[model samples]
Target: MTTALRILLLDDDPFMLELMTDMLQGMGYENVRAESDARRALAALPEFGPDLLICDLSMPDMDGIEFLRAAAEAHFDGSVVLLSGMDSGILRAAETLAMAQGLSILGACSKPVPRTDLADMLARAWQQREARARPPAHGGVK
Candidate 1:
């Protein structure tokens, strides 16, 4: 079920991008697109129409914060998982900022993320997707 989600991985480091792609593929997520540039990732959003976006916070051209802003402006409604090697406090702050921007933030994690943690996050995201897809419950009035 979760494997059907289209996921976009954005990172400036080519090695990190490849590693993440490999990790996601190993975890049964086949529809994954990796981009080394935030701008290109933003441009690909409309065409890709990913269900989830895994983004690294530290980048040369445009950092993840800026990328999140751009994504919000572009009206991206998918969930976001922020990845960074920065301080935990900084990562938390980014999560807050993303929430404030109306982005459905899945969560944030440090770099070199453990497979277990990644799997857990993905599971939560899948649950959220399922919840969103369900129709609202009706009252007893009917």
Candidate 2:
């Protein structure tokens, strides 16, 4: 919802990847990219320069936490939305761990991801990104 931000969607499930891509396109996002392989997703990260990453936690290639660690090492400052069908507790732990690793963990949600929740998450991430880009203002000294 904020200025055609480049977004990357990574999930081992091809169906989920397609669904999320279509949804993003339907929402008027023109620069959305989907990666079914987590390894490829990592490779694409630098070149894609995405403003956000929506990734699945339980992938065969690389788990979400591992990916988040790599992202952290790579200094990926963009917000991350972790998706999973696992127990809420596990998801919460991943969210907490990702945050501790210094990746902007947005909010973890159970799959199939709720469209409304996804939309809200993206908007919130975009707002934070925009805020970070803006220079702070100061009052004139007397």
Candidate 3:
């Protein structure tokens, strides 16, 4: 069985947060921390320090892209996944911008996150994170 991973899910809607939290739990990720307040989410980050961060595109305090920039300044070295109901094209463009800003964006998905989609994104992010964390092959001892 895959180990349960810590995940921070941020959304402005309370219902969305609850639904996603339940879905994640059902997906075998028991350590999910849900926050309906995007502003509070920023503060919770240092304490939660989740393995992955899932944030909504439109939020009250800070949009997902702005949040990414703030997170980078805070020295958060983890994968960031954006969720939005906006057009895919727009999201893609935003993702490109985030990438240009040196943000470690793992992936993005539409709102009302589906079980299958979340699972796939989580799997890919985990793999990518692991690969990045690995030391370079052929150590300097050569």
Candidate 4:
């Protein structure tokens, strides 16, 4: 079930990105991709068609807020789990902003995120993906 989900991880620090990738792999996700360059990561979204995006909220070229805006504008409907070392209040604000912009935020966590928190976020994202893929229920015409 986990391997079927395509996940894209974005962070400015190459080491952080790699660490995130390893953590994801340890959780049994196979089709995971990590990018240290936010710009390139955004460009890759169309082709990647990821089911879930675990994005860091700060970067040099394009910070996570900009990334969220661009993704929304591009009509990306996939779920997002935002990561940041910023204050909790700031992260919550970003999450709120992302939701207002029509992005599905699965969860947000401060950097050096707890393993259990990340795992829970991934689980929630999977549930969301499954929900989106489900067919709508039928009803009688009005």
- By TM-score, the best candidate is 4
- The regions of model 2 sitting more than 4 angstroms off are 1-3, 136-142
Question: In angstroms, how far off is 119's CA in candidate 3?
Answer: 0.9
Q: What is the RMSD, in Å, between candidate 3 and the native fold over all Cα? A: 2.6
Candidate 4's C-alpha runs over 4 A off are: 139-142
lDDT at 56, model 2:
93
**Candidate 1: segments with Cα more than 4 A from true spot:** 138-142
Residue pairs in clash, model 2: none
All candidates in order of TM-score, best leading:
4, 1, 2, 3
Question: Please, what is the whole-model Cα lDDT of each candidate in the order they appear?
Answer: 0.91, 0.88, 0.79, 0.89
lDDT string, candidate 1, 1-142, tens digits: 7789889999998999899999999999999999999999999999998889999999998999999999999999888999999999999999999999999998899998889988988887787778667677773331
Q: How many backbone clashes does candidate 3 have?
A: 0
Q: What TM-score do all the candidates reach, one by one?
A: 0.92, 0.91, 0.86, 0.94
CA displacement after TM-score superposition, residue 27 of candidate 3 (Å): 0.7
lDDT of each residue in 1-142, candidate 3, tens digit only: 3344668998888898999988888778888899887677888889987778898888876888888777777777777788899889878977887777776787777887777778887887677667666887976431
Model 3 segments more than 4 A misplaced: 138-142
Residues 1-142 of candidate 2 have per-residue lDDT tens digits of: 4657889999999999988988888877778899988788899889998889998999886888898899889889898999999999999999999999988888999998888898898898888789767776564332
Q: For model 2, give the 10-residue run with minimal summed lDDT.
A: 133-142
Error of 1 at 20 (Å): 0.8
2 or 3, which is superior by TM-score?
2
Best-to-worst lDDT order: 1, 4, 2, 3
